[model samples]
Target: MSVNRRSILRTTAQLATLTAAGGLLTGCGQEAATGGGAAASEHPAHPSPTPGAPTVLTPNRIPAATPSAAVSGAPSAESAGASPSAPEQPPLAANTPAEVISGPSDRPQVALTFHGQGDPRLATALLTAAEQHGAKVTVLVVGSWLDQQPQMARRILDGGHELGNHTLNHLDISSLSADQAYAEIAGCADRIKALTGSIGRWFRPSAAQFATARVKAQARKAGYEHCLSYGLDPRDYADPGAEVIQRRMLGSIKPGSIVALHMGHQGTVDALPAVLEALQQRGLSAVTASQLCS
Candidate 1:
C-alpha cells in the first residue's frame, strides 16, 4: 500500500506531539526523529535484470576516509589546531540514472535504509548490529540533523555503511518550488561533502517517500545519480510494537527489496535482531543500497 501526502503530514504532526509530550521512546540519540511520506507512481522504473537471470554486479567500493579529512573541497579540520589540507575530490560521473526503485530481482539480497535524525546511540546500535550480522545499510541523513551531530557522518562511514542525503530540514520536496527543492538538495549534499569528503552515495527526497521528477532533476544537479525509493516499507516510524515490526519485515521482504526503516525508534532497534536473523535464515543477506544497486 502506498502512503499518501495527507497521511504522511498527519503522522509528522503526531510524532511532533509525541516528542513534545516526551512519550515517544527512540533509540540512543538526543531526540526522536520524524518521517514524511509522499504519493508514488504505481509503477516506477526499476533496474532491469539480464535475460533469463539477474546480473550480479560487484558492489562498488569506496575506501573509508579519516574523520578529520574532508571528502570534497571543504577544510579538513574544524578545530583550532593546525591540520593538513584534505585531498581534492575527482569530478563525479555524469549521465547517472535519475531513479532506482530496487536492485536486480535475481539476487537473494535486500537493502535496508534508515532515515536518520534521532538518537546517535540508537544509530550506533543499529550500525553495530548490522556489522555483527555481516550486513551493511544506507543511512539517509537530514542536513540539519547532521549539523547537530556532525560526527555521525564519519561514524556511519567508519562502520562500512554508506550515507545518502534526505534534504535539509526533512520537508516535502514535491510541495516546494524548483529553487527551494534545489536548495534542500544542495544543502544536504554540502553537509555530506563537508563531513565525508564527498556528496552522499544517493539522494532520497525528504518529507516524501518518493521523489518527483523535478526533485530528481534537482538531486542530479546537486550530484546524486540516483533518487532512491524503497520497495518495502514496514512503517517502523509508526512505533508499532517490536514484534509487529519484526513480523512485518520478515514476512514482506523479497529478493532485491529496498526496505525503508527509520532511526530513533526503539521499536525498530528492538526488532532489528530478529529481522536480521530471519533474513539470514532465508539465505538472504542485508546490504547497503549502493551495493544492491551496483
Candidate 2:
C-alpha cells in the first residue's frame, strides 16, 4: 500500500484545521446512523475490502471525558488506563469517518486483532503468545462479555493491549434499527468504561467485516470517531488447524495490515508463535491497532 498524496495532504489539513476549542472529539454530526446520509470518512474514503488498503494518518484518540459508570469495584488503573500517559492524538474535525481498515503503509507494522469473548485461559494464552514474541494486540470486546468477565478488562489493558467496543450482543449490527444499533455500540462502550476508565478507543461492528453507512453513523453517535475494520481476515474463527491459519496469514499479510483473529480457539493460540516469527521474517512488527493506524 503506497502512500496516497491526497491522503497525506488531507491529514495535514485536518491536523491544521482542528479548532483550539473543539477539544479531542467533536459532537455527533447531524446525520443519524440509521437515518440516511453520506458516510463520514477521515482519510482514504470508500476503501475496498481487497488488499489495496488505505494509508491513514494518526487518528484522534477517544474523548478524554469522564467515564460513564456502569460497573463498580473496578480498580483505579482499569478506571484510568495506563496508556493515557502517552502522547495524545489531535482532536478530530467535523465529519470524521466512522470506520478505519488499515494504517499508513509507509511503516513496517501490522496489527493483530481479536474479537473478545472466549475462554479466559485461552484469551490469556493468546496474550502470552504475543507478549512472549514482543508483540501487542487489540481486542474488540462485546459489552456483555465484559459484564461477565470484568477482570479480563484489566488484564487486557495491563498487558499493553488495546481494548475497544464490539457491541453488546455481538449481533448483526448492520441490520438492526438505528436505536438498536446505537445501543449495541454505546452499550459496549459503557461496559468498557465501567471497567476501563476511557470509553475504550475504537468500535468494530459485529458480524461484519465492513460497516454499512448506517452502522458508521450509529458508531459516531455512540462517541466512536471510527469503527475499526480489518484489511486481513485469515478466518481463524473457522477452526482450521493452526498450521492452516498460520499459512493463510503469512501468505497474505502486508505492512499496515490489520489481521483479524479470534479467541476461544486453541488453533489460533497455537498459531501465534509461528505467525509472529513469520512476521519478523517479513520485517513487520506486530503492533496494536492504535500504533499501526497512528
TM-score of 1: 0.70
- In lDDT terms, how accurate is model 1? 0.68
Best by lDDT: 2
Off by over 4 Å in 1: 1-97
Tens digits of lDDT, candidate 2, 128-161: 9899999999999865556556788878887888
**Poorest 10 consecutive residues of model 1 by lDDT?**
45-54
Q: What is the C-alpha local distance difference test score of each model?
A: 0.68, 0.69
For model 2 the TM-score comes to 0.70
> In model 2, what are the clashing residue pairs, if there are any?
79-197, 98-227
Tell me the number of clashing residue pairs for each predicted model. Answer: 6, 2
Candidate 2, which segments miss by more than 4 Å at Cα?
1-97
